[model samples]
Target chain A: MRSKVWVGMVLLMVALLMISGCAKKAVRTDGDVSQAGQDAAALEAEKARRAAEIEAARLAAERDAKRLAEEARLREARNQFMNEHIYFEFDSAALTPTAVSVLKEKGAWLDKERAVNVLIEGHCDERGTNEYNLALGERRAQSAKAFLVDMGISPSRLSTVSYGEERPLDPGQNEAAWAKNRRAQFVVE
Target chain B: MNFSDNFLGGRVRRWRRGFLVLGSLLALAVAVCPSASAADYGYIDLTNPYLRKIPLAIPDFKSVSGDPATVELAREGARLASQTLDFTGYFSIINPGAFLVDPKTMGVTETDVDFKAWTGIGSELLITGLASLSGGVVDLELRLFDTVKQERLLGKRYTARQADLPRLIRRFCSEVLMLLTGNPGPFESQIVFVSGGNGQKEIYTCDFDGGNPQAFTRHGNISLAPSWSTDGLWISYTSYQRGRPDLYIRHRLENRGAVVAEKGINLNGQWVPGRFELAATLSFSGDEEIYLLSGGGKIIKRLTQQPDIDVSPTFSPDGGRMAFVSKRSGSPQIYVMDMGSGHTERLTFEGPYNTQPSWSPKGGRIAYTAMEKNRIDIRMIEIETRRIVQLTQGSGDNESPSWSPDGSLIAFSSTREGPSRIYVMTSFGTDQRRLLSLPGAQSQPDWSPNGIQ
Candidate 1:
């Protein structure tokens, strides 16, 4: 019976030791899981920072592209407005009916764009003397300017210049080319 | 004739004695025969084109200093003299290869000339020259002789720097022409015109024979309508240098130029004869009109008050009247306005497009370019009778007719060869030839009035 009692006490001690070992392993495992969770949270925060940087860079690139597109569009619009010129007959400063119609369009545009100033350049064909052409070109420019002023455009916002036969849009010595060169061009300042 | 004989030296006097003896015999023979007296003096008709050209012999010039460089220059001088005379279309040069006398052994003095040899080669005139170089100066002595009469026509000596050789030659040629035609040659003058390509036009001046072309204005802009002052010391032209059509006068010898007129559209300024006043087209009054401006760019007076385009004013030789283009008749036409009375008269009525009227120096006619059959041609009209004469026809678009200083030839621009280039022709449209073969197209040639003395 006494031996039986000692054996029971030894078995109880072994049980206590086994239970303590299990409790310690459980505590260590819980600490390891909490550390792993903190590491994963740090990794997640780093990923969020990287994603934010990428998003910012993309937005900036998109804004630059959009700005350049807008600038090109404005430039093209200005060119289109200036491309329309008023033409005249050979050695005549009288504005044709078609030329007056075109000038009306230009006048309307000038009315809307009040801040824009322009120069009216008069040109002539190579048919006459350079000096005479210069005088004729001046008359053509003045004629155009007068029509624009008559159409309610401010004369101060418009200036006149005569290029004469010095500058020709077509350098060919032909009737068709001369008809193209005899024109009044518009330049935005 | 007797004065020239007295100017002869010793050996020349000896030859003159022999010539006099022969001349006396011929005179005696002519006195006996009435028909022989008709051939005594050789007179060339200036208006006759069917006459034979005077044959001239120009031997190699002698180098008095015996220097190699002087020798080369002497030969060149002789060659240039021959070329100058040949270009006048009044003389035919006798080839040196056909010479019977040795040029080296022949002395430059008139007595040393073998008149028989020159006469044998069908030369009516003989030229002998002597050149010497000393201290960077070249001295030349030239003499012209009538081979048939054995008389010295001209004797002159010129001394200048070696660089002035061409001028010396031209002066001698002018003297020769004066002796022949009673009018001094225009070879010493210059021509100013517009020349450019690739959208850059500039004013250029060249020798009358199209030698030594130089750009006078490098404004990097349009410069045109160059006109010379009566003295040729200044050139007035229209320039866009300051971004407007204005007038500028360039002092050719001083190498400086200034804007003379900056008022609105100061284009085509022409100098009035014997005056510092300029007649130019100005648009300051909101219309093209002619105005008189002083040399200082001051507006002296307004010449035209027409409500149409009036430009390209050219003064008469007397400065009493002005001929210009006016569009008051619904088309460009030539008009004349008396400067004193301001009474204007229409001068052109035939051509629909008559412009660039250049008043002749003779004050009898006005030459201009007219449009005909869809092509431009040069034509002239008499100021008094209104008789029209077509100076150029079937040539590619001839325009801008300018008269020579002597009014014997017309210098105009034509596109006959390809590009518009300066051309020259007689008053009757003969001997049409290109004036310049420059790299770019040249136009609007205005001959200088005369050599700047």
Candidate 2:
């Protein structure tokens, strides 16, 4: 009877040991699955941060290019107004309708830019006395300035000078040369 | 010697002639009955200053020998000599038809020449010349005799080409004038200026009396205010070719030119002795300043470093002094500068604006433009004498008076018409005439020497 009771106790201890070992193995597998999920979450966060940085860099480059293009366009427009020279008639200080039209265009440009100063240079052909031609040239320049003043430009932004017969556009003593000489020109400062 | 009341270019011819004839008869009656009183001083004063025009007789010229060309040249010489003395307004030419001694009978070299016949024909001065052409060259021998003194005043012989007969004549005439009045003749000289109206402003040159107008420059740029060198071979002018103003030297002999003031604004350059220094209005400093530059384009000196407008500088005949127009006085006025001392003196005080001063070659007179009311006229100021002579009386805006080398005429630009034209007049401002008819305008007349030859 004593030998039979000892075998029973040993069998019971082995069964308990097997049950504990199975539970421990199941817990280890669950830990492994949790570690794999945490690694996937870390990789996804890194990919999202890199994508956002690239989008911001591309937007900045596009904005810089657009600003450069805008600056170039302004420069070209300013040059167009300054490059042209205005012409006038022989012995006539009166501005023609065509000259007025041109001035209007110039006024529009000035209004848009608002930083340029216009210089009205009064010039005459080499026909008249120097003193008289000087006076005539002044009159022509004043006339042009008056036109500009009437066009809503500030009078303070304009200046006039008369070269008289001392300056001629054409050195030839012919009708063609005189016609070219009788004029007032515009310069921007 | 109140001869007649009739003159050319006058009005009321018949009425004035009758009135003057009646008045002259009454004055003669009164003169016979007048006592030597203060009221009679007027008649006596007029009689005391009895200056009469001296009579001269010019023959067709006596040719003793030489080829046809030689004879032709001799006659031309005599004709030119006669014309020169006659234009002085001092001598009168006796009619050739009134000659008592025929040239065919009496020789020009006669020692016992009959002075009685010439005197009776109202001749006080006599000119004779003989010309010979050989090897395509002309040898001209001329003689001038004061008939009253019966002494030869001049006996000059010259050699030139056959084509130079006219010029030779003019020179001989000028010599006679020099002997009579210590002043040289301006006939052989030229006038340079600018003309406009037809459609262009071109520099034109002509004789002192507005004859032989010729155009010299044809740059598309504006050309004006041509000043001549003492030799008249080179012209200093302002040109606007590089879009900026610059001075240019044009050599008529070489037919070549270059910009002397290349980098700065240069206007109205006149020549000085031994150097090409000019008084130019420069903008190198961003404002118009007067600078003195060497002929080689070196900035030798700066006359005015201020910012006011200064232009139109004329050097005195001696080149020791200069007269220029300056606006430092708040308006344009004539100013004089002494070169040695670098001192300046204001010369003009009359007009609201007096500019474009041209110093006479005699160094005595300053010709400038003075404002008259609203018009401008040419005026003269005698430096030593302080004598003011108002030259022009026209309504045209006259400016830029360029005196002849001989100081007998002035060429200026006027705006009497719609455009400016070049005009020549006596220094006294009596005779006026236009030189160009091109529909385009012309201005700035500068006289050259006998350079075309």
Q: DockQ of candidate 1? A: 0.35
Q: Give candidate 1 regions above 4 Å deviation.
A: A1-77, B1-52, B64-67, B106-112, B134-136, B255-263
lDDT of 1 by residue, B1-453 (tens): 001112323343444444455435432432232222223112211232312457899999888877899999999999999987776655678999999887767855667788888899898989998889987788888887888877776777788888888888888888766665545667778889999877778999988777789998899988889898887888898888887788887788786756754545888767898887778888878888998987656789999999988999998999999999999999888999999999999999985788888888767778888875578888877787676767677769898888778666688999999998999876656667898878878998998876753
Instruction: For residue B279, give model 2's deviation from the true position in Å.
Output: 1.7
- The digit string of per-residue lDDT tens for model 2 on B327-423 reads 6776677888898887988888876777778887756778888775556677777776445666665657787788767665677777777576777
Residue B301 lDDT in model 1?
A: 90
Assess the local accuracy of residue A71 in candidate 2 as a C-alpha lDDT between 0 and 100. Answer: 76
Clash pairs (backbone) in predicted model 1? none
True contacts kept of 2: 0.04
For candidate 1, give fnat to 2 decimals. 0.47
Using all chains and alpha carbons, the TM-scores for the candidates as numbered come to 0.79, 0.64
Please name the candidate that would achieve the greatest DockQ relative to the true structure. Answer: 1
